[model samples]
Target: MKKYFTQLSYLLDSQAKKTIPLLILSFLFSSVLDVIGVGLIGVFLGLLTNPHFFLQKFPDLAFLLQGLSEKKIIGLFGVLIIVAFAVKAILTLLIQAKVIFFCQLLLVRLKNRMMIAYQYAPYTYHLQRNSSYLISRIQDNIGSFIGNVFLPLLNLISSGFIAISILSLLAILHPFITLFLVSMFFSVGLVFDLFVKQKLSSMGKIVSLSNGEMIKTIHHSLHGLTEIRVLGREDYFLQWLSKISHRYAHAAGILVALQQIPRYLIENMIAIFIIGLTLGGIAAGFSISGVVAMVGMFAAAGARLLPTVTQIMSAINQIRGYLYQTQLVYEELVELESITKGSKKIKSLYQKFDKLTFSTIFLSNVNYQYPHTDYSALKNVNITLHKGQSIGLVGPSGAGKSTLVNVILGFLEPESGQLLIDGKPIDNLREWLNNFAYIPQIIFLLDDTLRRNIALGIDDHEIDEDRITKVIQMAQLTEVVQQLPEGVDTLLGENGVRLSGGQRQRVALARAFYHERDVIIMDEATSSLDHETEQEVINTIKTLKGNKTLIVIAHRLSTVENCDILLRLEKGRITKVGSFADVVGISS
Candidate 1:
């Protein structure tokens, strides 16, 4: 409970401070109206005991009461009661509106911060984590935090204030009666609290775990639908889903049962307390009217207090659940100590190359091991690439071709030895990456126009229409664009689903071309293309003789036949590097 309150306090403080004040004002107004309503009932009771109570106390009261008959007085009291209710309703609405607005604003800020952090986060963080889970944390979990946790907390606080105010009024009216009622209420609450505390926490953990699993399952089902159908595994998937559903149902049932038990217990206790108190008052020589007024006030207080207690208890449990989930997301967002901003600006890519003046770049005694792996992916590897060179890396499946590219791109930090960029140690690889553009095996395009996709938010001053046209032609995407309804302005569907694999790969290639960086790294960039398109793309690469450095990775041996250099990788080690003919042992 203490931990829950601590977490709630931190959450509230993170939101706008004005939210708290509005909540307090809302609670005060509602509680004041409830107490005033009870006071009005007491006044009516006094009037019933003595018709001219006010008239006899002060003669001026008769003038003030002129033209107001008993029926009229009752009607006026009713009007006052309705007005009080209206005021409470208005205040409640405003408070809720403020809470919703503030919670949403806070959620938006949190998501934005996480996104910005992700861009700066170490690549190892992404390599070790699931993209779906990270996406869920930023998009789904933040929303849940606001709705399930923060909103309920605000209600709990408001309800608590109202409950306290009513109890205080009851105490002022009759201390003994107030004490008896308060004790009875808390005793029942304590019993319920004890009964459900552990159970709620346990149920909360199960629900949270189940939620993550469900998301994982759905993500896999969508992404692998084609594979599932091809393999005829529909029944297998359904059986797995049924198991998950069963566990979810079991946990949900237990949670509902725990939640309701307290509600029923509290209600019965309130009913018995009201009856006993009224009977006691009548036996203690109180008039029937006095007993009636006492019972009426007690009932009103109970009505307010019962829901208030239940809501607070429920909110606490929910806060616990949300905090558990939030902690998982928070752990991912926290910064790693290793990543730091580059101390010096790499103003020019040519400066490093000019200094090195070497015909060949070398990686000697290199080693790299992935996290949670005992064996090194690349062990004692040695390799070299010449200046202004085109190198093709070839290997069978799981032969570390992608790993080598990741190392060159500085996406992975080698466990031992060094990676050199133009003979300069790759300490600030992020800064070094500015000189290179990478096209991955899998192409991803935004849901935007072809022109925007190629330009990629580059300013008008930076835009080169001639360059875009040249690359589109080189990538063999001229026909694809020409056929589109809007030509270059045609919007692509999500993930470029509207485009064929070959077309999507060409678009990605065009984007790399438009970047016009010093070095280009293609990781199976043409694997999705057919023989004709691949030939066109290879021809495009050949045309870039003096323009930029090119490093290509391809499974097809014919793809690298015209390359200036070729690097053959066996396991983690680079076994050979030479001109294509020299490596292939053939005269060109």
Candidate 2:
């Protein structure tokens, strides 16, 4: 229990501590109102059974009732009792309204915290985690944790206060009877709770783990729909999905059933206890009138006490059921915060880097190994990138070209190295990254207008039309756009499905050009283009010869033959770095 709630407590301390004062007042008001409302009903019952006997016990009320007859006094008490209950109902509604809003607001804040953490977390953190797991935490686990764990935790506190109020009332009327009923019900609650606690927790674990697996499977299948269909592996993924979904459904169903079972059992058991009390009173030879009044009070109190206890138990079961998910969310947020500590100044990846002058980027004695792996991905990688230089990286698979690029791009920090911009070490990565615009091998295009794809992140009205048009012509996307029905206004289908492979590469190129960045890094950018289009892209690269820095990663050496310098990396080390002719055996 301590282990499960450690993270939860930390989350509450960080996120929801502001609500504590108001939340305490809400619970206190609710409990006090319940006590007054039920106490009025007890007075009405006393007046019904034997008005004079009750009036005799409360002689201090004689002055107020001086001229009133017994019947009239009883009638007045009935009206006041109903009024008390009516007032309590209205107050309860108001309290519930405040609570609902408070709960929902807390949930929203918690989700926002998770989003910020994920956004600011180091890129290395993202690499080690599963996309499905991270997405599930943000989208699904948060909702479940709020409903089952957080809300229930609130209900548990509220129920405890209300139950104490009812138990206190019972104690006032008949101490011996109150003691007996409390002992009996408490034992039953304790024993039943102990019996089912482990079972519910186990079911919760299964549900949480199974939900993650199911989401991962579904995400993988959907994201790889094209590959799955082309390779005829649909049945394999389908069967795996069905198996996980079945397990998730079963575990979730069982958890729900367990949370409700205790309520029904407690209700029936309370009924039997009340019946036994009634029989015991009859056998003791008390008058029916006296016995009825006594039983009536117990009935009203028990009615309240039973449900409150049942609600408390049900809430507890739900909290236990969702224990794993709650802990996961808390830990994720906390871990992200720790990993991304001191990153406040380095916030925006799109911040202006033009003001920071840099003549060269120097890498000295850089070595890197991926987490949980013994083998080094980059070894003693020493290199320099000067202004207005075009560098080509050519290597076989597992040659660590990407790793080296990642280090330079600030996605992965080298284990032991000095990466200096000009003469000083680069400290702010987000600021450093603003110097380059990256075009990946596979471009991720939104199903939006062509203009938006070219000038991404800028609003439609805010996009620079002249820049978009210029990059389109430069990247050779102008011809394709002109052929479309609406030109730049044409909406690309999902992942730019509407565009051909070569057209998509051109669109990506257009986007890179539109950024107007100081440097451009193309990751196999022309692999999708035909010979003519590839030459077009190469010609486009040549246009930046004296204008901007370029880093090209490609297997086709012909594309990089005109590059100022070629880097030939074999294994994890750069074997040759100089002019293209020096790096390669033959000249361009």
Candidate 3:
């Protein structure tokens, strides 16, 4: 329990300082009101049964109420009972209102934190994990954390305060009955805990795993819609999703059943205890007033204590069921430590990027091997690229062309040698990435307006129309824009599905032009384009020859015909380094 609380505190961070105290104050207030309300019920009933009793005990009671008869006393006490109960109800609802609102608000903050952590994590961390799993952690898993851990923890605390307050008041009024009630009900709760602890733990694992699998199935179906349709295997994925979803639902339902069954069992036992107390009062030969006061007190305490005990039990079950989920949140909350291991000194947002000019990139016998792999992806790779040079890399499949680009981009750090930019080793790869425009074969576009797609992260109002028009012309997309009814305002569906392959490539090129970076890295950007369209893009590339650095990576050697220098690679080593024709003949 202490460990769980510590994790919760960590998850809340500085907000725990405020939220924790507020929760304590609210629950404490509600419990105090409840205790006062229950005590009054006994006083009200005692007045109705025998006002002479109080009158004799305090003779001043009759003197203080000059015009009051027994009837008037009854009426006044009855009104006081109603008012006390009404105030208690309002306070309880107010406590719940504050707690629920704060919990939901905290949920949004937690979601934002999850996204921020993912953004800060290194690129290799993402490569090692599936995107769908991360999405599940952010989406479904956090929801479970709220339902199974966060809110339940709150419920457990508030109910614990209410139960203890009522039990203490009952002990003051009738010690023997309080002892009996505690021994009976608490013992039963202990027994139930021993009965279902293991089952709930297993169910927790099932629900967490099954939910993630269901989400994975959905991600696969949505992202691979074209492939599924072509292979006529849509039903296979559908069935897989349903199977996992049903497993998740079943586990969740059983865990809820485990949580709920205790409440009803505790309620039934409390009802029998109440009946037994009433009969015991009659058998004890007490006066009508004494019996009425005793029985009323027990009834009032039971009315409050029963539900409090039930909720406390429910919360205990919640903690047990979501132990794993707490661990999940704790891990993600601290994932930043892994990302901070190597380069703990990079904080460039915009200013450093403007001055991030480089003279040359020198690779010194760089070697990299993927984990759990037999061969090195890049072995003793030696390359030196000067500023404002158009360099092309051509190699066969599995010849480490992509691996070399990733190393240069700092996505994967070399295991053996150093990558020096302008003769200085760079600790901050992110700052270096800011100076590059990576135009991949596949452009990731959202289902949004063309202007927003081109200016990806900027708001619609912040998009510069002049810059958009200039890039469109540079990428030879002006003619395509003229045909669209909305022009740059046109909507591109998922991954630019609305445009043809060539048109999408041009949109990507226009985006690169819009970025206006010092280095543009194109990875088979014109692989899917026709000969005429590819030549047009190549002409645009030739126009930027001496002004900007271009690193063109492709399998088709013809695409690098105008490159100033070409590096031909075979089996992770440079075979030839010369003019395009010199390397193209040997590579082809």
Task: Give lDDT tens digits, candidate 2, residues 1-588.
Answer: 687667667766443677766777788788888888777777778778887755676888778878888899888888887887788789878877877787788778778878888877787888898988888888778888888888888888888999888888889878899888888778877888888889888888888888888889998899899999999999999999899888888988988888888788778877887788889999999888778888888888877787788889899889988888888887788777766664653454325444356889898988899898898888898999998999888887678888888888878888988777887876666667767778776788989999999898888788988998899998877779889999999999889989876688788878878876778887774344467655744775688787888888877777777788889887788888988788777664
Q: Cα deviation of 348 in candidate 3 (Å)?
A: 4.5
TM-score of 3: 0.94
Candidate 3 per-residue C-alpha lDDT over 1-588 given as tens digits, one digit per residue, 9 for 90 to 100 = 798777777788577557778888889888898898888787776676777756764687677657788887878777877898898888888888888888887888888888877776766777788888788888877877877788888898899898888899889868888999999987898899889999999999898888778888999998899999999999999999988988989999999999998889888888899888878888887776687778887887888887888888988898889888778877976776445544553233212444357889999999988876888988898999998999988888778888888888877789899899988887665578777888777777879878777777877778889999998888788999899889888888788888876687678767777877778887773345467656754775688789789888877777778889999888998888898767756553
- The TM-score values for the models, in the order shown, are 0.85, 0.93, 0.94
* Prediction 1 TM-score vs. true: 0.85
Give candidate 2 regions above 4 Å deviation.
1-5, 13-15, 69-71, 342-355, 459-467, 525-533
lDDT of each: 0.71, 0.81, 0.81
Give per-residue CA lDDT, model 1, range 1-588, as digits (tens). 675555445444345565678667867777787677666655555465555644664577578678899767666666776787677778778767877887888878767766765665667777887776667677767677777677777777777777788788889877898898778767876776777778766776676666666677777777788899999887876777678777878876787666666567777888998899888988999988668767876877777777776776667666655666665545555443123333232223213332223344567677998898888888787777765788788766667888888877667778988777566676544456766777776766779888878877687578788888998997678999989999888999877878876687678778877876667787874445468656744774687655667888887777777677888887887777788887777888
TM-score-superior candidate, 1 or 2: 2
Error of 3 at 197 (Å): 0.7
Over 4 Å off, model 3: 53-66, 287-289, 345-355, 525-537, 585-588
Model 3 C-alpha lDDT versus the unseen true structure: 0.81
Best by TM-score: 3
**Which RMSD does model 1 reach against the true structure?**
4.8
